[model samples]
Target: MLLFVIDLLGRTGPFSETLPAGIQAVVAGSAQKAADFHVNPPPAAQCASCHAEHFQDWSRSSHARSLTSEGFLRTFPQYLDFVGIRAREDPQVSMACFNCHAPLLKNADSEIIRRVAAFVVAKDINKLDGFEVGCVACHAEGNGVFSGPIRNPKGNLFHASKFSASYKEASFCATCHTWAPASIPCSDVYSDWKKSRAAKQGTTCQACHMAERVGITAVGLPQRKIRSHIVPGGRSADLLQKAVALHLKAAFRQEHLEVTATVRNLTPHRVPDG
Candidate 1:
């Protein structure tokens, strides 16, 4: 089944460019900026102020360690180096990844953007931790923001505040979930979901995956009225468990035993399984 999906996705690669303008932009831009770009951050400490509880929850999740982990680093030593090379060779792609993964704060001055761009071009992966996708990376504000900095991206803006009705909506997830039209078939989770019955029925990935442990029909636990920020549940836990299990398997295998493991995506935006 997975191979079928991959083949189907591969078939779509050539035709994907025929998708709409916005989709084309995403695909082309994502491929182009896989490495280099600059982005300013939002005001400092504002993210924490807005999502204190959620921030804590996210810190506990594996997603928090997306860009930083000794285990991941040891296994994929070339990620940073490759990013650097791509940044120099393909500034457009570098910019795309940087925007999604290591977004800058709004308060970051112009110089900050310049430095960020330079670092991205240099493939300075260490900066990934300091300016990585975090709790605010998704929830703070912007259209279709997943994780990372929101460049000069503009649209109906959402702001976080203590007194207002929270505006954490599906569009936020759509930013990352939706694939650029021109991208390969495997790259379009967001768009796939958008066309799915889930989206039409107003069921969001967050609703099923992040809500408290009430019945699937009623996940709104009284104490946890809002959704969970922990970002667990769904097949994600299954996937992560697979990662750990693979590591355990590797550890148990004799190092001297001749074996080869092809780690497909030990880097950002690449498919881990596909």
Candidate 2:
């Protein structure tokens, strides 16, 4: 279930507050921005020069391999066929998958996305990583500005930054965690969380996935409470036991046997969500 992974970049709606107004259409594959529109953020490797720790965490994350993973390579074609499109038949037509897998294309022109799609059809990995979901894909906003949940968002102290309350909200993840139509509940974790008890308690997705820890913000930045980027999921064995539970009961009444099984999902969102 590669679709099992949460893809926040595909639907830049959550980050649109900091990006250009047309970025929403660009990332969603709904339309392209005008030629005058432009954006260029540093790559994960460049960001690593300053945010070594954050980069280390992200480099090992599934988010980093959202586009380059072997499983994705195999699954993507099947996914296209399942949806009635064939990459071999029309690579550009199936390019919509890039919306989720290679969201950083939001900064590049649609022509760049088309080229990446051709590379994907050729199974060319060398040219793909640059477009993968990386540091800039999430952190960088319109132009050089960045945004996060930090109070006062003192990014300008070193560079440029913007205060983003959304960084602390579940809706941010839902922008891509959600893909299916209203009638269908495919990869609809956001809707499941909405009706869950956790939403009522105000417990967000980040509360669990991005549990905060005291760590360095940058190479020389002061140590502070920062949300971890090492996002775990249902596939993580330890997390599985912690977030899910099962109960079984069997009863016999009037020479008949009855069995009852109950599952308790401790997380606010649904388990096996996708």
| lDDT by candidate, in order shown | 0.42, 0.63
TM-scores of the candidates in the order shown: 0.44, 0.71
- Write the residue-wise lDDT of candidate 1 on 108-213 in tens digits: 4445544555554445665554455665464443432333222322231122222212234556666555545352222545665566665777776566556554
Best by TM-score: 2
Q: After superposition, how far is residue 203 of candidate 1 from its true place, in Å?
A: 0.9
Residues 61-89, candidate 2: write the lDDT tens digits. 77888777777777666666666744445
What local lDDT does model 2 show for residue 122?
68
Q: Give the TM-score of candidate 1.
A: 0.44
- Residue pairs in clash, model 2: none
Worst 10 residues of 2 by lDDT: 1-10
Deviation of model 2 at 143, angstroms: 2.0
